[model samples]
Target: MNWFWFLLFSFTSAFVLTALLRRYALCKSLIDMPNDRSSHSIPTPRGGGVAVVVTFLVALSVLLFKQLIPVDLFLSAIGAGAFVAVIGFMDDHGHIAARWRLLGHFAAAIWALCWIGGLAPISVFGEHVNLGWLGSILAAFFLVWMLNLFNFMDGIDGIASIEVITACLGACVLYALGDADHLVWPALLLASSTAGFLLWNFPQARIFMGDAGSGFLGIILGIVTLHAAWTSFMFFWGWLILLGVFIVDASLTLFRRLIRGEKVYEAHRSHAYQVASRRYRRHWPVTVVVGGINLLWLLPIAVCVTWYGLDGVIGLSLAYLPLVLLAIKYEAGQAEAG
Candidate 1:
């Protein structure tokens, strides 16, 4: 079957699987209990993301088997995705220590770095940076950070799904613009699977993506963006622009928490989206606004970076400056104070 039909299959599989996972979670009494730190008030079955993971991996593996994707990239993405999904699944069912989760994240990041042959020397506005060994180390850290920040931003009902769709579609567009069709298939598949999850997850919550789901999305996005950058280092920032919504909120919130001398490891309802959700007293509108910003503010920047071969530093700043203010205005790190 062509990848296009597989897109529909992935979406249908995710939707059906999400419903099944929700039932299994409810029957098994595996639920997320709402608390001071939580964004939801009612307990909902988590780990619906397992559906997303299974469908995406299965679809991607089929492509690999068909020799449709590069062998090294296929291995790295699936291997890293599987590793992080396991840790996240374990954390969802039984609490895994943060340190252990971090270790797993780093291990997965390193595996991908090895496969990608490390970060290629990058072009930053015509200035060259040769990272060498340091490039791989930095790339590993970048992957882990993306993995964890994605988890951090998965606070509201539909925000994570929105982020996944927006970023995936944006990546697809950028890749196509570059004539880098090799990378488009995985991104498109991810968007479709997440879209399936979104049907149940959005507008109202029926089930949550748990860590398994969100972590899988995170690791895969990291790998996809890495592949983008590997193809053309200029594309590193293009991927960043495409994902600016989650990237800005999560990165700034973490920075604020760190500066405030707060324990960053503890889950808190302090992300910008969380603050907005609390303000509106609903999740969907905030999710919608985020999607709006992604399409309105970020996608164009990504297009510019892809087509013009220009440094996205300006686009990155144009995109993030407002979000930084929103984070500050929302008092993103003041969950304890609030």
Candidate 2:
């Protein structure tokens, strides 16, 4: 019942499940082929995220059953995460209509919030702001966006896995520092499980996570942020700061696409990290660079935000400003195939 044991089991489970899924995908022809919009150069077995999700959920349920996590938190996260993963799994093997995906995302978001007891007054820069009727609507939008952005950033090898590890570790750090030990286990489990996947995903990816894994991560993380905010309003800022890399890249790229009259829903490799990967002609460097930024740059800034409970908005902007500039420098505004 100790966390370390659970962590080890989760990690090993994910690693073994990934291997099995890879072979299954190969046999099933579940492969992702390189295309004009893709970042990879060869067909690779995909749907590895299913292993990640299944292992994660199984571990999470054990923790919940043991009363390590609250009933509501467990229920909300499990319910929504499983549903989103199913949608993603379906999408990974074949095509799913955009509208249906959107609807599923909205439903999952609402399902989580409903179980988690809905959104409270949100904060910006240590100031309390109320959303009233618009709260649910905006929260749904944010949840959907978070899930989709993870999908967007999952283009290159190991990036999504790296980001999840960083954020989950950040959550553990913040909780430990704040003396909220009860909240640390979920983050620890998530980080370690993803690390198991990262071993096979990085350097040279043997398998891709597909839509199922990426979308599952997004929903879980979105719920995590909301739950953290509920725990301490300042915690949301810390969580966001931890996720700054993907948030900035995805948001900036989407904004640029909207400005340039591009279809926002279409596939493209124009994200900031994607641009950097193209520039370097490899995925590792960009992945390392972003991982470094999360650790060296954002982590310290996030600690300040979570610790100070003041100037979170300012700290967040300060943390993101450089990433935005870097995206611009790399011409993330331009469409790939330009």
Candidate 3:
């Protein structure tokens, strides 16, 4: 019952805050103008993701005050996520060099690792493997990559918001199925927060999430994945499966661009989702398709892994195979067609 109110509070706070932020962004001329490398044509207000960050963090702080969550989880989510969000917010206001931004991302990853006790042992092919110190390094890089990929994937209307909502809600269900009730509230709250923001971001978007919101969500989700691994390594594979769409699309595009000697940091509309949106001549279809994929395709695989003892590596491969094919079909990393 208490958790229900928390979820409601999170949703209402994010909804009202996003509305206020939209007005503020317009007044301050913080609008994202369309360009050759952009997805949207008409200029729209951005930085509305600040509402999600604020609402989620406030709810998290309250949970901490009530001792409803562990201190390490609180620090990892709040401390590291705040660092990512602050840097992202600053970058949204003015240009920040990619190098500095990457450095800050690494720093935040380290903070999260320090509090969360580094990467927990992970299951691989029915055997638990502890990577020891090497795990820490890999986890740090993983966190950085997750945050960056999220930033890259937040190109179209409501896609990023929808991804977060579905992924988090899926995770909450996994936790409940595994009887890890303590883990459900945080994930539920995150979904609720993003759901409120989606109202303003879906289809013809009235506002954008900007780097602040997307990057914060990336690191926070990564942290949640790690935290869940501490409880059950299979849950890590579940998360990896749940986030398969973004992970597969962003990673494939990035690697392909790197191989072609393209400067990956510069913005471009070559992602699978972006190309699909252009092909469909609307953003809503692509967004809706992503949501459909999450609910219908990925969620069941995640449940199988997290609750049914499916081998983590095999499960991930099963989950990613079709997505990889889809990325290729969409020309995820290819140059935009004329």
lDDT by residue for model 1 over 1-338, one digit each (tens)?
Answer: 57667889999998999989989999999888898888898888888999988898898889898877888888898899999999998898899998989999999999988887878787777787888999888888889888888889888888899998988888888888888888888888899999999988888888888888887888788888777787887678888887887887888889888998888999888888888898989988999998898888888877887787657787688878887888888877665563
TM-score winner, 2 or 3: 3
The global Cα lDDT (0 to 1) of model 3 is 0.92
Candidates ranked by TM-score, best first?
Answer: 3, 2, 1
TM-score of each: 0.97, 0.97, 0.98
lDDT of each: 0.85, 0.87, 0.92
Which candidate should be chosen as best, given TM-score against the real structure?
Answer: 3
lDDT of 3 by residue, 1-338 (tens): 48777888899999999999999999999999999999889999999999999999999999889888899999999998999999999999999999999999999999999999888997787677889999999999999999999999999999999999999989988999999988877888889999999999986799999999999999999999999899998888889999999999999999999999999999998899999998998999999999999999999999998888878788899989999999999999998757
**lDDT per residue (tens digit) for residues 270-334 in model 2:** 88888788889999998988889899999888888777555778888889899888988987757
Per-residue lDDT value at 114 in model 1? 83
Better of 1 and 2 by lDDT: 2
User: Cα RMSD (Å) between model 2 and the true structure?
Assistant: 1.2
What is the lDDT for 54 in model 2? 90
